[model samples]
Target: MTPEPQAASTRADPAILSIADAIAHPVKAANFPQTILRFRNDRHAATIGLDALDDKRWCHHFGRFNPMPGNLPQPLALAYHGHQFRNYNPQIGDGRGFLFAQFRDDKGRLLDLGTKGSGQTPFSRDGDGRLTLKGAVREILATEMLETLGVHTSKTFSVIETGESLWRGDEPSPTRSAVLVRLSHSHIRFGTFQRIAFEDDAAKMHRVVRYALETLYDQQNGENDAAALLNLAVERMADLAASYMVAGFVHGVLNTDNMNITGESFDYGPWRFAPTWDPGFTAAYFDHGGLYAFARQPEAIHWNLGQLAVALRLISDAPPLIAALERFGPLYQQALVRRFCWRLGVVPQGMETDRALVGAAEALMMQGGLGIDAFFFAWMGDATPECPADQQGTEGEALWSAFGAVKAGYAPARVRTHAYWQGDAPQSMLIGEVEDIWAAIAERDDWGPLSAKVDAVRTMGEALRG
Candidate 1:
C-alpha cells in the first residue's frame, strides 16, 4: 500500500491512467464539459450521470473495442473499495465506473478522461451496466452550471448516446443509453483506503496513502509517514468543506467513499445549489432526514474526515490526526467569515457587522423562502432591501443601509426590473449587469464570454475597495 514512485505493482497512478493511448476510439472531447444523461434519476446522489457499470472501455483508436487498451487502466483500477450509504458496503469499487485514462490538458492541468455507462467490473454487485439518457442530460446541466459558478468540479469532457432505449423514473421508459466522459484530477475515493484497510492490507494501505500524497497533494520529494499523510488529508478536507460553504454549494451524498482525498469535489450524486437559505436543504431526493443537507454538509464532511482518520490510524497513532481534526471548526469558521466578508464588499475586520450582515441575509432569505442562489441573485439588485440595517451598529447595519441607499439611488428602473427580485430593493447599476452576465456564465461553458465576465467581476469588486 505504499506510494512508491512507479512501483512494480502499486495502485493506479493518474499518469498510468493517462489518455496517451485514447486518441483513436469513439471519443469526443467537446468544447464544453458534459453530462452522462442516462443516470440522472438513479437517486443515488446529485450530479448523477449515466453509470458505466457494465460497458467495457476501449482505446480512443479502437474501431469496436470491447474491454480496455493494453496500456490503459487495468491493474491500478483494482485498488478501490467503498461503503455505500451508511452501511458498510465493502463490496464497492468502480461498480458502474472506471477511469479511461488520465491526461494533461493543453494548458497543463492534469485531467482524467473516463467513461460513465461503461459496462460492469468485479465490483458490479447486481446492477446493469447501462445508463439512461436523462441521466446524461442532467449531468451536463449540473457540470456546466456548477463550473460557471466558479466551483472546483469535475468537468464533463463529452457525452455519447448509444442510440439504445433504457428505462428510468426521471424520464420516459425505454429511454436511450449513453456514456459520459469527465475530466478530473483524480477518481480515487476515501473508500479506496477504507476498503483496502478493511481487507488487512496494511502495507498496501500505507502504500496507497503515500502514493496519493506524493502524486496529488504536493508531488514533492521525501515520504510522508502515515501521521503526516493523515494530517495532510484532514487539512485538505477541512479546507474543501470551508470552500464549499463559501460557494453556497452542497454535496448531497457524502459517504466516506464519496469524499476524495485529493481535495476536489469528487462525486456529483444528489448534489444541489442551496435553493433557499434553509441550511437543511438536501440535494438528494432520498435524503428525507437531511443527512446530507446543505446546512449539514460541513458537519457531514467532518464526520467523513473522522472516518478517514480512523482508517489512517490503522497504520499510525491517532494523536496528530486528532489534533488535525480539532482544527476543522475554527478553520471552517475563518473560511466562512472570510468568504462572506468578501462577497459583502467588506474586510474581515468587522466582526459584529459581518456577523449581523450574514445573519440578516440568511434570515431575510428564510423569510422570503429564497434559495441561496435566488437570494444572492436578488441581493445583487436589491435597492429597497426587505433586509433591514441595524441603525445602531457601525459596521453591519451601516454598511448594508448605505450600500442599499446608494445602489437604489444610482440604478435605472429598467435595469432594476431586469435584475431585481419581486419586491426587493434596487441594486447598484454597475453590478446589476454583473449578475446577468454571471447567469450567462453559469449556464454556458463557452469560455469566449466567460473569460470576459470573470475579468469584469473581479474588476468591479476591486473598484469597490478603491
Candidate 2:
C-alpha cells in the first residue's frame, strides 16, 4: 500500500520529472543485456486508487507503461557491494535493481524510492533480470499484509502482471512473469559496502558510508562530524533487528547486502512469521542450512552490521565503530523484550516473572503447529480456558484441554464458536470468515470488516491487559 505521507501526492512535478530524467541511465552501474517490454500496473493494488483509471499505476517506476526506459542512476546513485550468504562476492551493486529518484515531500526531505525487476542492467550477469508476474502478485500480498502486521518492510507501490511464463526449475514449473514497483526509503544493500570492502577500495567504501550517513542519517549531521553518522548507523541496525525479532518475523535472507543502515526493513523475499517458537524456522526455500533461521535472525543482523563495521573501519578509526557494534546485543535484547511485551498485552519491566511468562508462551507455540497469523488473528476475541484437571501441565495440555472450556469477552452467543471441538465450532475459522467478509466488501471494497477486526483485536488485548 502507498503509505499516508504528509500531504504527499502520487503525481510527479517538474522537479520530480527532472530527477527521473537526470537518472535515466538504462545500463550504467553494472550494465547487463536484455530489456523486455512487460509493462503492466498493479490492478488489484489499493495505494493508487483504482477509481481513477488514469491514476491506476505507479508512474514513478515507469514514466509511462510498456516502454523499456533506460535508468541512468540518479546523479547521486552511488555504487557499493557486500557478502551474499556469508560468502564474500565483492563484484555487485544494483546489478538488477536501480534507484528511480528521490521523492521529496512538501517538507523537502528526500525519500529514495526505487524499483526492482525492471529488467537487465549492466549488472544482470548470467541471470534474468525481469521479475515474474506471480512474483509481483506475491509481493503485493506479502508487503501489504506485512504492513498490516506492523513489520518494517518495503511497500509495494505497483504490481504489473505479464502473462508470459518465466522458468524457475526449483518449483513445479515455469512461473508467469511480471514487474513490481517497490517503494523503499533506500535500496542501498549491505552488499554495497561488502563489494567495496571486498574490492579493497577503502576510498569508495568510505564514500558510500559518508554518502549513506549524510543521506539517511541526516539527523546526526549537526553532531560531531563523521563519527556521529557511523554511530547512528550502528544504532539503527541494532534497533531494526530488535523490532524484527519481537514481531515473530524472520527475513529468511539476512545477507549483508540486505541490511540497510537506515534501519527500516526492505528487500522482501522468502520472509515469514514464526509458526512455532523453535527459532529454527527457515522461510527461504534456498536456506537448507537454516543460516537465516528465526532464532538466528537477531544474530545474523548483528553479524551483518559487524561486516559493515569492518568495512567502515577501513576508512575510520576502528575503536569507536567497534564500541558502537558492541552495544548491538543489549540494544536488540531490550528492544525485543519491550516489543514482545507490548505484543503480549503487557507493560514491560525487567521482571523475572514477566520473562518467564514470555518463555511459557513460546513453549506453547513450539508444542502447537499454529499458523502465527491465524493464531493471533483468531485469538483476538477470546481464548478458551484450560481444563481444571490439567491445570499444572504443559502448553500441549492447555491446547488440548481448552477445547471444551468457555471463552470470555465475546458475546455469549460466540461461546460455541470458541469451543475448539473437532465435532463442533465453525467449520471454517477466522481466515475463512474474514474471506467471506472480504468477498462482500470486494463488491465495492468495503473496509468495515477489516476495521472491525482491528478494533476487536485492540479490545481483546486491552481486556486481557497484563
Scored by TM-score, the top model is 2
lDDT of 2 by residue, 398-453 (tens): 65334322222122212223222222221111224444453544355454654454
Task: Write down the lDDT of every candidate, Cα atoms only.
Answer: 0.54, 0.53
After superposition of all CA atoms, the RMSD between model 1 and the true structure is: 10.8
| Residue 276 displacement in candidate 2 (angstroms) | 1.6
- Model 1 poorest 10 in a row by lDDT: 38-47
Tens digits of lDDT, candidate 1, 198-241? 87767776667666766566555444366676666666676677
CA lDDT, candidate 2, residue 13: 19
